[model samples]
Target: MSRFMSAALCALFVFSMTTANASAADAPGKAVYDINCSTCHKDGVMNAPKLGDKAAWAPRIKQGIAVLTKNSITGFKGKVGMMMAKGGHPNLTDAQVKSAVEYIVLQSK
Candidate 1:
């Protein structure tokens, strides 16, 4: 191949690899939850909902997914004892919080 063509091909390959790596790093909701919410939710600390504990989560789940997502994103005040906004992870986006909440609810159910 010509020098210019080779350089272009290499640039394309590098860009593709970078995009793939970024997507992989983004991962899914469960991973985000584990990293952020798990600190309290998993162990039931501070009255936070415990993962896979249907009894504890049933009423919250009953409130519906929309309510749950709203509370999660906006932060629950005096609900389920005490929950901070975005589970104290301000960097987490609303979509990420919703996904994490869904993952938690699914596991609880």
Candidate 2:
């Protein structure tokens, strides 16, 4: 391969890795969210509020992150739907639940 081609490939690889790391850092809770919240949130199951749906999430967002985290950890019964404690995974830690909530809020808003 040409020297220029090798350098370009190396740069591309570095950029790809950097981008992936940046995204992961940006959404620190994404892993937790995927495991615990995606099932319901992704599809809006039982009116859980679909992830990234601004309309559905607007009111919830207005409630603020603290409220959202609390509800996720303790569970909530709202007018339209419910959220299970730790997203039905009781084994999850408080930090995990909070992280998931943060991720949801980030995606939502």
Candidate 3:
């Protein structure tokens, strides 16, 4: 192949790889969890579910992701503890909250 053509292909390959890696690492849900969820979930603050805690998450998971997302967005007061709407982050859009919920569920299960 021509030198210029080879260089162009290499550049394209690099660009595509970089984009894919970035997207995979910074998935919407993971990003939201890093910012909004790590605080409570990481430490189980105020009884928040810990990441990868399948036993703790079993009942909630049975309730389904949709309900879990709703509770995360609208706020849930459970016997263990209460979660404020959007984890008390008013700036969070419903989509963001849902993403966080999905991320947590994915990790737990």
Candidate 4:
């Protein structure tokens, strides 16, 4: 094959691989939350809000997304209890934490 054709094929291969990796990484937030937060949050341990429990989540939900996201990322010790940094997952990106919070909020609602 010509050099130009080989280069094009290489580029296409790289593009396809990158897209596949991105999609794999983009697995739903609920899955992330289940793997991470559900340990405590699912059963309301340490006063962590239980999944799908709107009443338990109501007050925090009222605080709005921005505040909740901040708390989730930075950690907080509030009247309810302590939330660890990144919900104790230091490796989680801010976007991932936000997505997890969104999943929780959606389920709670």
Predicted model with the maximum TM-score: 3
lDDT of 1 by residue, 1-109 (tens): 6999999999999999998677647756777788999999989999887999989899989999999989888888765586888988999999889888888998899
Q: Which portions of model 1 miss their true places by more than 4 Å?
A: 1-27
RMSD of each: 4.9, 6.6, 6.1, 5.0
lDDT of 2 by residue, 41-77 (tens): 9998998899999998999899998998888899999
For 47-80, candidate 4 gives per-residue lDDT tens digits of 8889999888899899998899999999989887
TM-score of each: 0.74, 0.74, 0.76, 0.74
Superposed by TM-score, candidate 2 places the C-alpha of residue 10 at a distance from the truth, in angstroms, of: 30
Q: Summing lDDT over every window of 10 consecutive residues in candidate 1, give the lowest-scoring window.
A: 20-29
lDDT of each: 0.86, 0.88, 0.88, 0.88
- Please provide, for model 3 over 22-55, each residue's C-alpha lDDT reduced to its tens digit, 9 standing for 90 to 100: 9657776887788887899998999988999999
